[model samples]
Target chain A: MSGIVIIGAGQAAGQAAASLRQEGFEGTITILGDEDSAPYQRPPLSKQYLSGEVGVDRLLVRPEKFYVDKNIDLKTGTRVGSIAPSEKSVTTTGGDRFEYDKLLIATGSRPRILNITGSDLEGIHYLRTMGDVDGIRESMGSASRICIVGGGYIGLEVAAVARTSGLDVTVLEMEDRILQRVTTPEMSAYYHQLHAGRGVNIMTNTTVSGFQGNGSVSAVLCGDEIIEADLVIVGIGIIPNVELAETAGLKCENGIVVDDHCRSSDPDIYAAGDCTNHPNPLLNRRLRLESVPNAMEQARVASANMLGGDRVYAAIPWFWSDQYELKLQMVGFSSDGDSSVIRGDKSTNEFAVFYLNDGKVVAVDAVNSPREFMVCKQLYGKAVNAPDLANPEFELKSLLN
Target chain B: MPQVKFIEFNGTEHVVDASKGESIMVAATNNLVPGIDADCGGECSCATCHVLIDADWQARLGARSEQEESMLDLNPDRTDESRLSCQIPMTDELDGITVRLPEFQY
Candidate 1:
């Protein structure tokens, strides 16, 4: 057999390689990553790594010797130019060709770049890769005033870090409240107060019309007003890397369309992670999650199916964000929640909001309350009494059943 | 710096010096010790860094907080001495501490 060849050295690809080996696949395994660095955790790039709490050595998913010991071929800094599914082969930018019995497209996602005027100005950066964080870190030292263009997790986390480092930080959000896109207004209000209380200026309903400076960004034009800044970090969001899969005749919608098994249109080809829009039976819709847990879970399912094992990717998606000292852990999706119940006291900064749709618990967003979040995660898609859920005195552990 | 020992379920042992203020999970992952996934990167959200502290060293590590205790409760193989390695910070008192790995952490 020609063995399995994965075309992305990210979280999904790394997990796929490891899971394949653990599943007793003795075939030749090869991974091609565009990045020069080995497969490392991306979650810490904004939190621990950016803050210099963790070193680069600790970010790796596995040690350098792991690939060698497992007999897996890892090609760093190698980009796959195109994929020919008909021939089961892939061509690289460096003019190399390889064939495989099974192929996985774990290309992942890229940071979304704003196309506004002066976006290319110096001193403005996006946090995505190791290099991006390094650039921001270098800029953070000499910069006293920092402006964040988005109020998402990345922007908020970076704001928290910058403020802790004694920088004057200002966050610009186009929405009426921060985290409005993914969270309820109540949750967003809590964060707004948290960041504002920490001496960070958070401007909601603020649009960054453009950037202004002499060679480097010194201020951002937010509508009618201009906010002064020595540095700017844009955390707009990310775009899934689907050009390669789309060009290879694979189905692509918002992302490369994959089944519950993580298989693409081609029989011998599969896709996973942030690049694939896979179907979720629980939600009754297709989801493209940009989370590490989603990536790793899909990779495991894809790896199993690649080895001819029948497995479906059914995972309860969970995400966590660390801002200052608050640990916000969210499970399930709360987009379509019709009703929400707050479990803990919001004034004390310890609470969890449970989202319900059609009387069933669809999601839970817990801040500084992991225990409630853990219990709510198990109750996904199950009906629960909202009053009881909102009652702080209720024993949450007993409701797990 | 404090020295910590991590023993895999398969009987492989690794002893390394750990820096103060960093979590024990960081020490294990930094030393390339196997079986301590710590997938959440010390967030205590994921219990991938589940470890059973040696009975003798349990007191020195102090009591587990309610959050840490609940996180460890998610693990099926958790024991009375079970603690999330990510929750324990490296200190001088934790030097010479031994934590045995679980059969698996997911």
Candidate 2:
């Protein structure tokens, strides 16, 4: 019997396979992935790759040689259709059968496309996979004006890239401000300023009716404003790829439902990464994190559990986004808080905002301030009595120490 | 070019020629130091390339920017001496400096 079998070839699956071996699971390890390419970092694909600062090769999480060295049977371009809990096996899309002692479902999420009119128009792309980036990157060359449907990280990141390349970029968001759902209004104002300063027309509280063109996206019609565009990148968000799990009779809510040990309703089957909706201790709620840190960490925790080792996957959700020269680093959920203190000048786009819930620091958003972000991730749930974080003499290092 | 003493990880220190314009991470990566994994490629995105600045050299390198501070905060078990090697650019006074990497990049 195969010692361990992990479905989905993304970071969580890749890490789980490797960790199982590292933890001394010598039996057959099979990692099934839908994508042909090896597991690569998705965060960089939107930033450095979009900016042309890093090459494609550097995006890979690990080289092909590492898999060979680790003796991991890295099965690329393979998709697992469903899992038979009673038989202790998985059936792939190609009808190949694989039996396993332990199963890990790391089937990651995919971009949620708008189901509206003109959604099928050409030149309208969703930024999710490697192929999507290639499509957007290629179109960016000739596209004079680009309309990004969502004001999320991916859309803003692509906007930065397009603006840098001298393409007129316009971001359309239905919300009152960009990142309204994810970050504080202070953060929204800061990022909004930075993007607008870069000549990115951020149109918030405005909805895109749909695309306008015969076969291709020529303009995005929102209200009365018909903005002409050569290309449209939709980065609204991602819906967990829970179809496989749901079909397999796994309990799924917003995402693939998993317990603390990352075990699906089936004891033998486990899930991790962006696809799984696990309970977050930090937020005291069930939260689905779509970040690399969460994916990689959960993979490690889940892999240990699969090996019969007791390990709980509890890590603060952390993510970073690079737009132009600004690095936005966030740790924990700062959605709705009692107050927030700005640590530096927002105009210069270099500062950290401490998100306080009733007096305790619940989360932090660091704009171009990574070290403070690093410290605050450790200080989560701590009673930080800071009257004013913007006090010039107040150092984040002391709070950490 | 200024000669700075980089403990070649051999326990014995060796002096390598570094230009003033380059960052310490750039100098170390360029000189083929095994420890520094400058994954962000000197952009200070990932905190992989972490190092401890020599106490005496701390005053000369100036203070860590708020951006650098936030990045370092994400670093596990960081120190006052902990500095993202990418942020510390080599300068005229940064000679004879030494840095040590943590046992495990945990």
Candidate 3:
């Protein structure tokens, strides 16, 4: 049997392959990846891995032997050129065609490149894959001053690591504050203070006009101001790799549009991870999430549905980021809430921000507060007293009862 | 290297050698012992690596930290023996410690 053929050997692809085997699918599984290495976790690329606390071996979702022992044919560095959905086959860039009874499109996303003058210069790097991080690590060896363009989670995370590594780090955010797109004003202020206190210079309301250098990047030009830099890292964001899916005649919105079952417009085709804009029944909305938890969970659901089992992907979205010594864990969408109430003491840097709308808890942002974060995860769509949430002595567990 | 015994929900048992200082989750994932997802890669944030330790070896492995306890508290399948495998480092003391994998992570 041609069995199941999965595109993109990422977190979603690895999980889907494992989940299928777990569900007793005794069929051939083939995973196609453009990267030279096997599937690995990307979260640490900006944290421990970049900080040199962990190595590439630990980043693997599963060891190379896993594919061998599980009898999974993982073709690394093989890019699928196009999909002949009608024929149930895919042609790779190398001109090898693989026929499949079932196909899973998990092409994932790519780092959005910064296009401007001198952006093509050497030493300006973007973090997305292992090779990208390896290039940045090599640049860090000879770099003294590093300028980060973008104040998102990635930029701040890389800033934290660079600052801790004793490099002169500066973060330029076009927005008024860092994390403006994903978090509230209070959270943005908290991180701004946190990074500044750690000796990382943060420039808000700043725009990068272009990079300044001949052969290698030496400075970043912001309008008329020149920020001296030995290296430049851009963390603008990512674009979903949906070109293949779109070419295959699959529905494509902001991402590959899929149903609750993670099935695309075609009945036999399924998609997951950063590339799919699936529906969340709990949130009662459709959105694309760029998170490992979402990717893994959706893959599980997609796998089940692929095997003729009914499974809905309605998980409450969650994400975490580690900066300096603080751990920030968030659940649900902060945008769904109208107002937010702070729990615990912000001065001590241990607290939870509960977002509420119409007296119902919609989401939470827990900082160094996993106990409350765990409890908050269960509080989604529940009505709770705001005063009790703000009270430090109030028992959050009682709300469940 | 210390040895770790992982018992799947289906009563299948696999005993593998685990290096000291590495976590039981690492041993399970590295050994290709299914059921331990460890999605967060030992970050303790994702509770996918939840496992129930044998009652006889619970005290030997020591108690879970407050963070670990909080992460475990969310799991409906959690019991007195439940622990995040990522938090339990495989030391010489835990050479023959046995852990049972849960049926589902969530």
Clashes per prediction? 0, 19, 0
Instruction: Put down candidate 3 lDDT per residue, A233-330, tens digits, no spaces.
Output: 99998999999999999999999999999999998899999999988889888999999988988889999999999998988888999999999999
DockQ winner between 1 and 2, please give it: 1
Tell me each candidate's RMSD, in Å, in order.
3.6, 5.8, 2.0
lDDT of 2 at A141: 85
Judged by DockQ cut-offs, is candidate 3 incorrect, acceptable, medium or high?
Answer: medium
> What is the fnat of model 1 with respect to the true interface contacts?
0.24
Instruction: Output the worst ten-in-a-row residue range by lDDT, candidate 3 chain A.
Output: A392-401
Please list the residue runs of candidate 1 whose C-alpha ends up more than 4 Å from where it truly belongs after superposition.
B1-38, B51-62, B73-78, B85-106
Q: What TM-score does chain B of candidate 1 reach?
A: 0.94
Best by lDDT: 3
Give the lDDT ranking, best first. 3, 1, 2
Model 1 agreement with the true structure over A1-401: per-residue lDDT tens digits: 88999999998898889888877899999999999887889998999899999788778876667788779999999999999988999999999998999999999999888888888889999998998999999999999999999999999999999999999999999999999878877788889999999999999889889999989998999778989998999999899999999999999999999999999999899998999999988788898999998898898899989999999988888899999988898988778689888888888889889999999988999888877777766788888889998888877766664
- Candidate 2 residue B1 Cα shift, in angstroms, is 26
Query: What is the per-residue lDDT of model 1 for residues B1-106, given as tens digits with 9 covering 90 to 100?
Result: 8999888899988998888977888778656576876657676787778999868899787699888987766455768889999889999988889989988875
| Candidate 2 lDDT tens digits, A216-299 | 889999978899999999989898999988988999998889988898999999999999999876577897878777787788
How would you encode candidate 3's per-residue C-alpha lDDT over B76-102 as one tens digit per residue? 687999999999888998888888999
Candidate 1's interface RMSD, please? Answer: 4.1
Number of the candidate with higher lDDT, 2 or 3: 3
Q: What overall lDDT goes with each candidate model?
A: 0.88, 0.80, 0.90
Q: For residues B9-96, could you state the per-residue lDDT of candidate 2 as single tens digits? A: 4464546666686677766644445456554455666676778776778878889877577667656557888888878877777776
